[model samples]
Target: MKSAMMEREGFAALVLRLRSEGISDINLLTAVEQTPRSRFVAHHLAEHAYSSRTIPIECGSFLEGADLAVRLLHRLRIGAGQRVLEIGTGSGFMTAVLGRIVERVISVERYKTLVEEAQTRLDQFSIRNVILRQGDGSNGLPGEGTFDRIIATAAFPAIPKTFTEQLVHNGILMCPVMVDDERCVMVRLTRTGSRFEREDLFEVPYLPLTPHIASYL
Candidate 1:
C-alpha cells in the first residue's frame, strides 16, 4: 500500500520538481525521477518522499538538493569505462545513477540495512555493475580498484586520508566540505603530487561523518 503510493510519488517528483530545476541531464534526471526515493526511506516518512525538499532516511537522511552528485560528476569530466568509488552510499540513489553513466562503481556504506535495502531498490531498476559493500565509508574500500572518480555523500571536515590514498593520479574527488557557519561549500579536489588543488563550487548540506557502524573497520 505505502510502497505503491511512494512509487507513484517518485514519478510525480520527476515531473514537477527535478525536471524544472535545470536538472536536464537526460540520463540523470531520468534515473532519479524513475528511482523511488520513498522505497529508500523509512515507512513512516514515505508520504513526504516526493517533495523537492530533503527527507530523512535511515541512520541519517537524504534530500534532493542541487544534484551535487550530478554536478560533481560533471566536474570530474568522466569518460566511458571509468571506474568510480563512491563513499557514503546513502540511499543508493547516487550509486544507481553512477552505474548507468559509468563503466562500473564500487559503493560503500556504513549501515548494513541501508546497504541491503539500497541494493534491492537498485536491482529493481535492473542496475547492474554497481557493487555494494558494507563498510566504513570514511575509509575507502580497501583493495577496491583505483578510482577514476571518487565522490562522498557525507560532509568532510577535511578530506579523509583513506579516500585520497585510493585515487589514481589525475582522478577527481568531489564532496561537500564544512568551511564555517553559513559557509559550507562543495568542492572538487584534484591530486597533484602530494598536494590537492581545491576548487569551491556551490553550497550543499550533507550528513556528517560517522565513527561507528557494525561494519566499521
Candidate 2:
C-alpha cells in the first residue's frame, strides 16, 4: 500500500514537474507546494489544485501556475524590505506568495466579486502583507507612487507606460504581453539609467487585461 509517506512523495513529484516547466528556484518551489492552492480555488476543483496546472475559479478568473509566477518574481529579484505592486489578484495565490517574500504588496483587481472573494480567501490565510483594491489596472494604481517592483498577471498590449513611471529607479516590472490574438508573451522590464528594457518569454493565454471592469476581470 502507498502510505502517507508515499503520498508526500507524490507531492514532491508534482513539485518536480514545476521544476521542469522553468521554475528552477528552490524557495519558489517550496512556497508553491506549501501554499494551500486548493483552498484558494473552487471547492469542486480543490482536488486538482496542486496538480501544477491552472484551475478555474469563480468570476471567470483563473489561478495561474504558482510555480511560474514564483519563478518570474524571483528572477525579477523581488526580496524583503521592498514595496511591490501587482495588477491582478485572481485567487490571491500570488499575492500570498509575494506577501511571504516581499516587504509589502498592493494588488489591484477590477471585478468587485473577484476582489472580495480573493480578499476573503487570502485573509483566511492571515496574509497581512498584501493590500487588495478594486480598480482599473490598465491605468495603473494611481497615487501609489514609486514601487520597488511591479508585476502584472493579466495579458496586456505592452508594459503600461504608466507602470514605468510608478516604478522606482532601478526597479523591475513584469507582465505578459499579447503577441497576437491569443498568445501571451512574458515581458520583463528592468530600469537602466532611467529607461526600461524588456525581455519576451514563452507564450501564455490568460484573461485579458481588463482595462474596464466587465463583471469579470
Candidate 3:
C-alpha cells in the first residue's frame, strides 16, 4: 500500500514538472499522469521511470526523456480523433502515451525484440489503440496509409521525403534532424497540398535513425 502511494506521488511530481516545462494541454497531462511509465522500463530501472531522464531499454535503444517526449507531443498538437504514426517504439512509453491521446497509433521499430517487449507492455496497460510493427522507419511506413500526424524519435541528417509523402493533407510530421556535424534540431513539417512547410523547434541530442530491419537482437 505504501509503495503504491509513493508511485502516485512520483507521478504527481512528474506532472508538475511537465507543466512547469510549459506542457499546458490538460488531456496530455492527464494521459501522462495515468500511464505507468514504470511498466515500460526494466524492473531494475523502474524507479527512474517517472524521472525526466532517459532509461535504457532493449535493442540498444533508450526511452527518450519524459520532458522531451512530452514537449514534442505537445508541439504536435495531437487530437483525440487523429491517427498518429510513430517512427520509433523504443520502450513503448511514448507509444502508450500517444495511444491514450489519439484514436489510433501505428508504431514501427527496427528491432523485433523491442517490438515484442513493447507489445507486452502495451498489453499490460490494456492499450488497444496502438499497433506495434517491426520495420525500418528511416522512411515512414507508407503502406499503412496516411496519418493525421507522424513523429520520429531518432535523428536524421535531413527530412526524408518519403515520410512527408505519407502524410495526409495538412498532416504534421515531427522529427529531429542534424543541423550541422555537431548538432541536431527538432523539426516540424506540415503537408499542405503538394508542398510541405517546415519549422525548426529546438536542439536535441539523438542518435541518427537507423535504416533496415535488424537481423539479430
Candidate number of the best lDDT: 3
Tens digit of per-residue lDDT, candidate 2, span 97-139: 8887788999998888888988887778787888999888896
* Candidate order, TM-score descending: 3, 2, 1
Off by over 4 Å in 3: none
lDDT by residue for model 1 over 1-217, one digit each (tens)? 8578657765665455545555556656565556666666667876666654576666555744424445555566665688999888778877877787789988888788778888998889898889998877777777766788998877878777887888888888887777874456777889876788889888777756775566522
Per-candidate TM vs. native? 0.77, 0.87, 0.94
lDDT of 1 at 100: 75
Output the TM-score of candidate 3: 0.94
Q: What's the lDDT for candidate 1? A: 0.72
- Tens digits of per-residue lDDT, candidate 3, 103-191, equal 99999999999999989988988999999999989989977888999999889999898888889998999999998878899999988
**Model 2 stretches with alpha carbons more than 4 Å out:** 1-11, 20-26, 214-217
lDDT of 2: 0.76
